[model samples]
Target: MAMDEIIPPPEVDLPRETEDSERIIPSPDVEYLPRQTEDTERKLPSPEVDYLSRQNEDILEQKEEHGKTTELERKEKQLKEERHGEEHERPHEELGQGTKLETQCEEHKRLERQCEELERQRRKLERQGEELKRMKTITIVYEQFRQWIEDKASNSSSGVSFIEFNPSEVDDSVPKDQNHCLGRGGYGIVYKAKLRNETVAMKILNESSRQGEREFKQEIAILKRIRHQNLITLRGACSEKFALMYELLPNGTLEDRLINEKQRESFSWEERVRVATSICTALVFLHNAKPNPIAHGDLKPGNILFDDENICKLSDFGISRLLQQTNDTGTPNHITEVPKGSGPYMDPEFKNTGKLTPQSDVFALGIILLQLVTGQSATGLRKHIVDKLEGKKLEKMDTRKQKMILEKLQILDAQLKLDDTSIQDAVKMVSLGLRCSNSERKRRPSLEIEVWPEIESMNKSECLYGSDEVD
Candidate 1:
């Protein structure tokens, strides 16, 4: 070397980029890529390269013993393992080790939860199986019970397995119509059914064929519970394939006579008053009855029937409910879905709010009294009769209209306005009718001693025993 000359290097230096070239070059040893790629990565050695180098031999030996490829060879071999795990494992590995560990832990927990869920489902299936077995047992028991009852009935009825417990089968020897067909209805068609000579009103429900049987059975149950001279009683029942019989009401129904112009003409004012009084008594009984207080449900003149003694009785308990005095009554505007009685006789309180107070029955009674005295349904009365009576007639009119015309002669005395008749008696009775017709239920007096005493005194003054004839 010359005294002033520097020593030359053994290796050649590579060119470096600068502002002039404005470019970066990659060495042959590395695979270069752009900065951005959602899922691209490059493998790098750990910072502790010396420690890794020392362990490399052991790791290599372990891989070889396990028949796995060396690290350098692994890349080529892994690429060839395309079919089994790479689609899943490669993506996971690219995501970073921290994410992979968390994902793996979550997967382990999910599998464990799945196993627990499967166990719970198996237990639920076992419980359902037991329930099915119990249901099967219950069905068998019910069948056995029915069989036993049928057998007992077969033995008791003189070899006739199903002797209909019907009132219509009174005397099998008589003509079918004359013998009282179980399913009888209306005035002329009514059957005089006999249960051992005790007659019953055998009216088959006439409205809907579907409702006939149900209505008959319901009527029977209602009549059976009631034992009154005033109320048409149900003596016995006979239920068959959509057929029924009731204890016959020999005198027929007030509705039948009232609706008929000629028959209603025979009704006297005295008889009308008597009928009205009897019905009020019946209502009192029903309202005060124990266990389940009834509200006639449908108290139309037609549903009213007379006995041979010319006495009236209230009948018909269908579409009725047992009044349950519950705490819920405190709510001012509560209503039950169930409806009450015939439309006209139905109380206004029952219309707005389903609270059934005794005043409701009183309201209906007031209308009945008016109908009896006027001898016609309120609808057919004089021009603005309701208004003429200070709107009292409208509020007092029963929603139920009589099928027959009212007795015209009953009000003859009042219409005549005889000088001997002070007319005070008629006015007082009419006032009672108006009081019953009050729209506000609370305004109407309950059917207590004070309410009926006024009317009863009038009947006695006319030599009537609560509107009954002295004879």
Candidate 2:
């Protein structure tokens, strides 16, 4: 402690970069480390020194803790940024993929719908093509028939007249207009036409088979010669197309009237009796022809038609055969290999023997009679009638028809002054029908001898009950 003597500064301990005698130098702008004065070091008490040392240690520990906390906060912020980026990118990718999938689905559905539509159109076109092909074939067939007819007409010199018909006149379009096609059958197709101030049904044969061509020629020949009130009248014919024009029957066929319940309601008992009588009359005329008796090969309800006046007319003589007459007797001989008649109404005897006679026609008439009695199909009626004849109950006959007929008869008895004779005549007629339809050809009754008498008796009863009542 000499007065005015200079003392050197004490050395300050500072952090070093390495332990190998290397002290860290601070930058010129940085403050130097703090150092205690000699007088303060000498005067300071032990407790005070200890307190300052503890304070320094506390400051150092506080600085270290603050640095560690800052580092932790920075790391946490970096992790959050990375997570946020990843979440944002994943949503964008998922959204893009979902959009692509939805677009693909929409496109697929649209294509499927278009494919289905195309398939439907293809099927419709195929059907149309088939129909066109059929028309073309028919047109070609008509042209062939026309040529044959022209040649025959030129050579024969027989007073037979036939009009030339253009095949184009009849087409698919002909069937679409008003009063179009009237009907079609196995032999020919019929169309409704308005011809020269008259409505006529034009029947054109397909002539696809040999049988059909033969029938076309035979029908024309048969219709030209025969003329009767019950027989259908021929208007004209086109030999070229094998088409024949006939008087139009607006009331349709007898089969339609009998089979259709709605039409049957309008057909009264008197009408049925009249129809039967007319058919019998026609058969009688055919069976007893001038030179040779013409056997109508097909006799069924379908062959019978009704005019505008509801008059019954027999038609379709395609399979009619002109029987040969034996020189010894004027009796008609059987025709062998005759074409079979319509099903149900055809005679089984004729089918077995291949012989067509007028008796075969009677068998069909018997079935028609059964149809008038019972509102059931004329087909398979023979079995039902035989069942009834065997003393068994009519299992197949409609019970509803019995009630309807009985009720109708009761009404007729009251209104038309009919008696038990009418009922007896009906029952007798049914009995006659059964005998006429007998499976044994010999057992079956003749249309002229046995059937005519019974039908005339029924007709008499109808007349007695007042024939004017039906008209």
Any idea how many clashes model 1 has? Answer: 23
Candidate 1: regions farther than 4 A off: 1-190, 194-198, 205-221, 241-245, 256-265, 328-335, 338-340, 354-357, 380-383, 390-422, 461-471
Residue-level lDDT tens digits of model 1 in 151-253: 7568874121112454336335234655454323331235554544444544444454434554655555555654544565454445653333444556777
Question: Which regions of candidate 2 fall more than 4 Å away from where they truly are?
Answer: 1-179, 207-211, 327-331, 392-419, 460-471
Q: Which candidate is the best by TM-score?
A: 2
RMSD of candidates 1 onward, in order? 26.6, 25.1
The lDDT values for all models are 0.54, 0.69
Q: How do the residues 107-190 of candidate 2 rate in per-residue lDDT, one tens digit apiece?
A: 999999999999999999987876554344333323433454577568774223334446555332245564477777877678
On a 0 to 100 scale, what is the lDDT of residue 433 in model 1?
A: 66
> Given candidate 1, what's the lDDT at residue 338?
57
